[model samples]
Target: MLVLDLVATLVFGVSGGLTAVRLRLDVVGVLALATLTGLGGGWIRDVLIGVTPPAGLADWRYLTAPMIGGLVTFFLHPQLDRINATISVVDAFGLGLFSVAGALKAVEHGLGPLPSTLLGLTTGVGGGVLRDIVIGVIPTVLRKGELYAIPAVAGAGVAVLGSRLELTTPVVAAVAASVTTGWRLLALWRGWTAPEPVRAAAAP
Candidate 1:
């Protein structure tokens, strides 16, 4: 679970750094965004579950992973810019990893399955939401036609269910992550979208 969380943080940091580069943000902006994207979700999860100080704040590796991502993007943005699709694919994987890890952690903290699932979804997408808001864009989770949150919810739910069933941690994590990553990738490749709300007709 620790390994999965760290890898997810690094992956999200990369995603955030790439977004900053695309926006032509300065070095500080890039680093800040990376750190927020990498650690925001976990921090939120920890705080909500009464874990003070947050693990990311306590662990040097957690802090370093985002720094590395930010520095790498700062130096290699030109090359990275050409691979937006690949980055999206990787971001999906990160989403899956975070979701399962968060759900499992919540379960360990004695949260009920439903709460664990919600926290897992939040852990998967909270950072991205913060990043988008900081950059003055609507969050993907809230945007029309974006299929971002559903897969996360599904993944978290699966992890929670697996835990309830007493499945091994590794097996639960793997299956839950696979479900999220696969669903997200398929959505991207096939242009799948969440349904939009209907607009009322205008008065003449």
Candidate 2:
């Protein structure tokens, strides 16, 4: 769980740093955004579950992961840009890992299955949502027709169900994460989207 969390943090942090670079933010902005994006979801989860101070804040490794990600993006963004497509895939992987990790933690804390699933979904998207809000943009998960949150919810549900069924944690996490990452990658490849409300034609 620790390893998975660290990897997810690094991936999300790199993504945030890349966004900062694209927006021409300074070094401080890049590092700040990276740390926020990496740790925001976990912090929110811990607080909601009544855990004091949050695990990310208490752990040096969690801080280090995002810091390294920020530095890597700061120095290597040019090379990173050439692999934008790959980064999206990796981001999906991070989303999956986070969803499972969050849901399991919630279950460990005695949250009901439904609440755990919701928390898991929140964990997957919360960091990105916060990052977007900080940068003055609408979050992708909340944007019309985006398919991001649905996959997360589905994965979280699966994780909760697995826990309820007494499945081993490793197996449950693997399956849940694969479901999320696969669904997201499929949506990206196939242009799948959530349903959008139809707009009436403009009045003449």
lDDT of each: 0.89, 0.91
The 10 consecutive residues of candidate 2 with the worst lDDT sum are: 195-204
What is the C-alpha lDDT profile of model 2 across 93-122, one tens digit per residue?
999999888999999999999999999988
Provide the lDDT at 5 for model 2: 75
Clashing pairs in 1: none
> Residue 19: error of model 1 in Å?
2.1
Error of 2 at 88 (Å): 0.9
Name the 10 consecutive residues with the lowest summed lDDT in model 1: 195-204
Q: After superposition, how far is residue 150 of candidate 1 from its true place, in Å?
A: 0.4
Query: How do all models score by TM-score?
Result: 0.93, 0.94
Q: Against the true structure, whose TM-score is highest?
A: 2
1-204: candidate 1 lDDT, tens digit per residue: 567667778878988898898898999999999999999898999999999899988989999898788888899888887887888887899999988888999999999999999999989999988899899998878976778899999999999999999999899899999999999999998989987658854765
RMSD of each: 2.1, 2.0
